[model samples]
Target: MKTSKIIIYDEPTVPEIQIKKLEKFLHDTFHADTEIRKNFFENREDEIFQEIATTRVFELKKPFSKHIPTKLEIQIEKENIDNSQNEEKILYDGFEFQKIISKFIPSNENDQEILNIIFTNKLTCTFDESDFRYHARALIGTNPAIISTTGIIEAPAKPKEYYLDLMVNFTKESAEKIKEKYKGEFLEYNDSRITEVVEGYLLQAVMYYETGEAFCEDRECRLYNAHWQKELLYTQSNKKLCKNHEESLRKIINHS
Candidate 1:
């Protein structure tokens, strides 16, 4: 493997992401030394929080521009609030947030062979020029990878029928009923299955760092880039990679 070490920062607000299980999973998968840290933003200076708050995405239809954050916004970051659990969601520009985070990483640990992966409950989004809109992304690929727990639940499209039901009902109660009807079909906040679902994303980050490819086209593979909730559930259910990726994994380890 190209990566010799991986440093994972935890999101304590989301207890479903058990840090030790993730640590063990990476060790078993790659035999790479792993270390866990508390939330990356924890104990950061007030300016760091204010700077990060400036990266918030207010207009999903437009490209990123620096936001003059409200006092509440900076306070939210300082408190390490998990807004993903609330109905009113907050979005941040993924790339911009990554840039701010990169500035905080120590100079000594800035090696290509050491992967730094951060887990957060914040929703991270990227602007797509093709669509001219910002879209939520579950994982952002790079040296210091970001895994958004909120994005994992919200990014993928839900069942079509669920939306159709809401369209016809058009009431809060009806929406809740519809959600309950399709509950198991998709992930929700604080879902127990998140622990299992996150493993697939971890595999994606690791494989991307090693091979320069972040996803598989095959739906049966764990590394498949799933755009829909059902696709995510199905691909992760397989609990394995495609034959080609399996071979690639062998080569990655062998060459190392």
Candidate 2:
């Protein structure tokens, strides 16, 4: 492993993430020292909040253009609030958000040996060149990787049948009923399965830093890049690396 230690920045709003349990999972799985820290956005500078506010994506179909944030938006950024608690969704450019987080790291602790993973309730998204549109991403893989708890629920596509059912005579109340009907099929806010799903993302971050590969093609693999909610649940809940990833993991650990 290129990283000697792993540090996780917690998202306190979502207690279902179970940060301490996640720390234990890392130690038991990788045999590495893991540390947990408080929320990353807390106590940040006014300028930092201004910078973060500019990363929000208002137009999904278009590529990223730096947003000129309103005073209210900047103020919203400054406020220490659980963003997920609100019904409205806010989107941030994942790479831009990662860059902001990278700058926030203390220089003394910023090094190859230290792997920093930030857990955020904000939805992080990336613009796809092929589709020419922004798409929510659960993990933004890098030195300071971001695991967006909101993205975990929103990124993956829900069941096709559910959407089909929703499209027919859809009303706000009807949509609520549809969501209730298929509640357990996909991750909801405050889902207990978040901790398990996050473990997969954490491993992907570590493996990306160590081996330069962040994802696998196999759905059975914990590192699989899942586009659908069912696949995400299946891959993460299994909690086992595929043969190739298992071998790669062993090699990385042994050689470290």
Candidate 3:
């Protein structure tokens, strides 16, 4: 199997102060002992790169030639919430807990078979789709309940940062290589919390794909559309724009 380099870019448009604060928060929260670096353009003509964050390098194994593994199944055991008669505490208060529950290339209808390889902090040795199939069958044979979400909560709280974007650049071969190597065992062996990281990446990617824009300081702002008008008035903000400005901006955006 061949491996390829994948680069994921996160461009955030936050105020300088807020960006610094966020960087500090992430570093402290994750206990990541790395310094955040800013890239500035010297040319006065160019717009400054607002904010940039990169993911640690991930080497993916390819299982097939056409598609890359976009999702994974991992075991998530929630800590017991204290819902006693005296106390009703909400777990992870004020924090939206979103995760990439399961992601795969989806070779077949048997989504259940993929559950067997989902072990905690264990990375499976490299294998291909065929290997995943075999391992999945073995898992089903031993424990049939692995696929069922008996205690897992499907839809959890939404995160505070509702808008996100992700740009993943990788060759098809590299993605397949990653899947091939860790088909059934990727989540189990990897020590890092794969669920949260993957979810964040996916959220970013989806936001970028859907909106065709980057994150902004104003979380409420949507690219090329006036979010204020939409929220303030019950109409598409762009449509509600003043006739002259609307026509001029439309012409500029359309032509440019």
Candidate 4:
């Protein structure tokens, strides 16, 4: 006879807005009266095989997004192995379960502005847990997205025991994109400071357009700003070149 063991570790912080969104997703996807119960783990016991899932939402302040992003993490542990092949079978089945859950999330919206503004932008997503090991540093776009699980599976022949640890992250990016797409669209900005700020932002946008890079560090830059924005000059003593000159030097150095 063979025996298997599964262990899951979860440590997530969810915000209120994303919690509601996740609940809606669950209700819509599963058609189940899914109520996200808090403090549900207080009754859990050790060495008992169980399936556990948790959801969390977080709001990132601007330069990122006004609306918060939602995250869901799930863990499933099972025991009792009867054969040598049971370990492989469990891993395959676990991945299949992850796939099914991934399909339940939403997709990016069809709106062009929304897609261009949000879906095209990239965001960082992270996955790290002790029991399981699959983790990635970043992901692109949003709206019902699935982050792959990571971790190790150990099956010892002599001990006749199998251990599987897995972690998966799900996010809703589409709705957040839609909300940000048109935010402040109709708001009037008559203040001179606001206008100047807008102009500066436009200047940065133009720089990005001409060079295929951002003027600031908010996003990746294909070319340095010094080379791209010749009109402005600021020196970096470390590089012994002004910002404009530094970027130009970078181009020169790269070309050479």
| Candidate closest to the true structure, highest TM-score | 2
Candidate 3 residue lDDT tens string, 1-256: 0001111111121111233443443333223332323311112121111100011012234331221222220101111111111011111100001111122212441242221111111111122355442110100111101111111111121122211211142567665555455443222223233233222222222233223333333323322221221231222122233444334334433432
Candidate 3 segments whose C-alpha is farther than 4 A from its true place: 1-13, 40-256
**Model 2, 85-135: lDDT tens per residue?**
424678999999899889989997789889999988788999999989999
Candidate 2 global lDDT:
0.88
Instruction: Name model 4 segments beyond 4 Å from true.
Output: 1-58, 61-190, 216-256
Error of 2 at 83 (Å): 3.7
TM-score of 2: 0.96
* Candidate 2 wrong stretches, greater than 4 Å: none
- Answer with 1 or 4, whichever has the higher lDDT: 1
The number of clashing residue pairs in each candidate reads 0, 0, 23, 17
**Candidate models: Cα lDDT each:** 0.88, 0.88, 0.22, 0.24
Better of 2 and 3 by lDDT: 2
Error of 1 at 41 (Å): 1.5
Q: Is candidate 3 or candidate 4 better by TM-score?
A: 4
| lDDT (Cα) of model 3 | 0.22
Compose the digit string of candidate 1's lDDT tens values, residues 172-235. 8888889999989999988888878899999999899888986999988999999999999988
lDDT over C-alpha atoms for residue 68 of model 1? 95
